[model samples]
Target chain A: MQIAILSGKGGAGKTLVAVNLVNLINLSTYIDCDVEEPNGKLYFSSEYNKKDINVLVPKINYKKCTHCNKCVDFCRYNALIDFLGKVKLLPSLCHSCGGCKLVCEFDAITEVKEPIGYIYQGDYKYHQIYGGELKIGKESGIEIISQLISKADKEKINIIDCPPGNGCSVMESIEQADYCILVSEPTIFGLENLKLVHELTTLYNKNIGLIINKANDYNNIIEDFAKTKDISIIGYIPFDKELAKLNSNQQLVSDNNKFKPYFIKIIEQIKQEVDL
Target chain B: MIIALPTKESGEKAFVSENLGRANYFYLYDTKTKEGKSFKNNFLNELHGAGVKTAEFLLKYSTDILITPRIGEKALEILLETDINIYKSTEKIARENINDFLNDNLEKLY
Candidate 1:
């Protein structure tokens, strides 16, 4: 079963939950789909095999071109335009549809592969780790996230750390996930973002559980939303200075005596829903 | 000669849009005839590549020169490909910049 850990915004302990869960589960695959800023590899460092993620962008052969606007009109992305009787192509905006080549009767268009990011695989302590890295200056990492998710080991219990927000990249990360774990903090901003993620999970019809970071008894706003949505509150990582200090140094706090119960308690609830 | 300027609206108070891509209207002035016309920027609502699209939209006017308060690299690249001489708009008012262009008071942007 694939479980996706998501947050409405960054720095909401999404990675903390995912990293601890993987360490406790042991013999599971950890796929980090946050290509833009994937730091999960730090906690699971080993000899990693890197593969480049590539996408095709159109290039125009200006020498053999006519002034026909068929290619420009056919492009839904508007990446191609007519300039001074010559065609200009914006590679960043191109979706690699290749319709421009198809519409070009003069055969003035071709595709070139551009390396946008990398897919890295490694293993440590009986856990398989995977990460996607997008190159600097690249506009979108949605493609890399999609390709990385496809590499997950289906047979092994997979725990995916999805990118933050309810955007295209986040949607791609959760496409095949069987269960969605929404993480939030105890603030109004966290509640608002969590609502969006909850709505998204409902739209995808996936079983969802909520983990409240820096949670306290007085955070009624976050508690109220989860109750209304009927989403089970699975776990909470309280606002504690010692735990934060230990986490920064130890990386994995699942084995620590204080945090073990909170991390372990959610396993039964997850298994019951996942197995069903 | 035909001149093109990115304008927020038509009339005396019409100012050059601070942003080239989001301009609501473009004012075209014919130097020989001394007549000006305003064309609605077609891609003002486009979420992406609006600046480049606006540059392409201006090609239909057979403009000889373009004066704007500011322009980005992508839009500047497209305009540079054509024969249009791009002049940096020194004045905020659309008509004053046209007068500035006529008087050769503006500097050419590479």
Candidate 2:
């Protein structure tokens, strides 16, 4: 089963939960889908084999071009432009949707491979680790995340650490998951954004659960919202200073006897929720 | 020479837009005819690349120069490749900038 860990707001402890959960689980594949700034690899010390990911972007053949502006008009990204007979392309803006190539009537456009990001594969103990790193100039890591997930072994349990926010990348990460764990904070900001991601999961019709991170007196808002939305509470990681210090020092809660039970309980609850 | 100003509204009372990409209207003033007109900028609401699309839209008018308070990097990239020269607008009113351009007072956008 694939479980996606996501949060609407940044710095809401999604990574903390994901790393701890992966370490506690029997044997699992952990995929860091936050290509722009993947932090999962920081906790897992391993020798990773890196691979490049490429996407096809359109290149115009000016000889056969009629300057009809069909490709320019078809590109919703506005990557294409025409100056009299000179056609200009801003390759970075291209989403590799191939609409421009399909719209060209004179066979003036052809696709060329462009490197967009990189995928890292490795192992930490009994678990497999995968990460996607988007190239510096690229905007969307959607393709990188897709390619990384495609490489995940379906035979084992997959723990996907999704990027923050309910945007395209987050949607892509959850699309293949059997269950989604929406992480939240105790603040009103967290509840509002949690509602956004919950609404998204509802829209996609996925099995959803919530984990209230940094639990304290302020958590009443998050609990009430979850209760109203009928979202199951998997488990809460207390806003304890020791846990934060250990986590900040790259120590896994699963490895420390003091905090192992917290994550173990979360795994047991997830197992029951998804029949794992 | 056909001069263009990124404007806030239609007609002579239209003020120059502070932004080049999401301007509400493009006011074109033909130097030979001493006549001006405003056309709605349909790319004003574009989520991204508004400047590039707006620049492409202005190409049809054969605009010799553009007057704006500021231009973004992406828009400036496309404009640099074209024959359209960008001029910095000193005033909020579109007519004042046009008069400045006619009197050689407005400076080229750096």
Candidate 3:
């Protein structure tokens, strides 16, 4: 089963649940779809085989080209600019739609692969972990996430740690999952944002359940909201200083003998829900 | 010549906006008539290529020059395709800057 762990807002324990759950579950493959800031790999030590993720961009051959300005007018992105009777290519603005290539009569335009980010494939013991790292200043993380999802082994259980927010990147991650683990905190802000995640899961018709992290004095607020939304409460991880200390040191509570049983219990409940 | 100045407000008393793509408004001043108008820059919130979109928007005014704090390389390339020239605005009110521009006191930004 492919499971995606996501949260509408940041700092609500998405990484915490994803990493620990991946460690708890057997025969699991972990994918960190948070390309902008992927910290799930920090919890486990593994050497990554990095590969560049490239996108097709236009390259112009001005020798055989006439200054017809067709490609310039055809480009909706304004990637092809008219420069003194010649066409100038701005690769940054190009969406690689191949409109310029189609409009060119002289066959002056050609597509070239440009690197947008890097994907790291690493192994944690017998299981596997994949992390996508988008180059800074590049706003396209959905492409990398799409590439990551395509590389998933359908035979093994997949655990995806998605980026925060309800943007296209998060949608791309959740779309590939058979089940969703919606993690949230016990605050008004958390509840408000959880409503967005809940609506998204319902809209997509994906099997989803809620896991409340940092469940301290505000448990009633989260539970009440989940009850109203008709979303099942899978489990809760308390706001413990010891766990916080271990997390600060880049360690997983699931790796600890004492906390392993708690995660196992949650996994057992999830396996039954997913009909595994 | 119609000159476009990035401004925070929609009037002569407005200070110049620092960034062209993210400016609140573009104040247009006609050198011959000394009349001014303001256009709300709707491209400020765009995730990408706001500069190019803003430059495309300025084409409607037949603007002869642009006076802003700075323009990006992409925006400069786009604006150069038209007749609009770029000039850097200094620490002065919008009205005074327009006067300085008309009097040829401001330096061309190229």
Question: Quick one: best TM-score, which candidate?
Answer: 2
lDDT of 2 by residue, A75-157 (tens): 88888887655778887788889998898899999999999989999999999999989987677999999997887677778
lDDT (C-alpha, whole model) for all candidates: 0.85, 0.87, 0.86
**How does residue B83 of candidate 1 score in lDDT?**
89
DockQ comparisons of all candidates to the true complex: 0.52, 0.58, 0.24
Is 2 or 3 the stronger prediction by TM-score? 2
Candidate 1 lDDT over A45-155, as tens digits, reads 599999998899878887888778899888877788887677888777777778888988999888899888899999888999999898875779988988888877877
The CAPRI-style docking tier of model 3 reads acceptable
> Estimated TM-score per prediction?
0.87, 0.89, 0.84
Candidate 1 lDDT tens digits, B1-110: 99988888975358988788888888999989998988888888887788888888878778888888788777877888788888887647888899888888999875
Best by the lDDT measure: 2
- Which should have the higher lDDT, number 1 or number 2? 2
- Could you tell which candidate, 2 or 3, scores higher by lDDT? 2
Q: Where does candidate 3 stray beyond 4 Å?
A: B1-4, B8-15, B22-48, B53-66, B70-91, B98-110
Encode model 3's per-residue lDDT on A152-258: one tens digit a residue.
Answer: 88888889999999988989999978999999999999998998888889889998888999989989898998888788888888888898889889898888886
Residue A68 miss distance in model 3 (angstroms): 3.6
Weakest lDDT window of 10 consecutive positions for candidate 1 chain B: B10-19
Distance from true position, residue A182, model 2, in Å?
A: 1.6
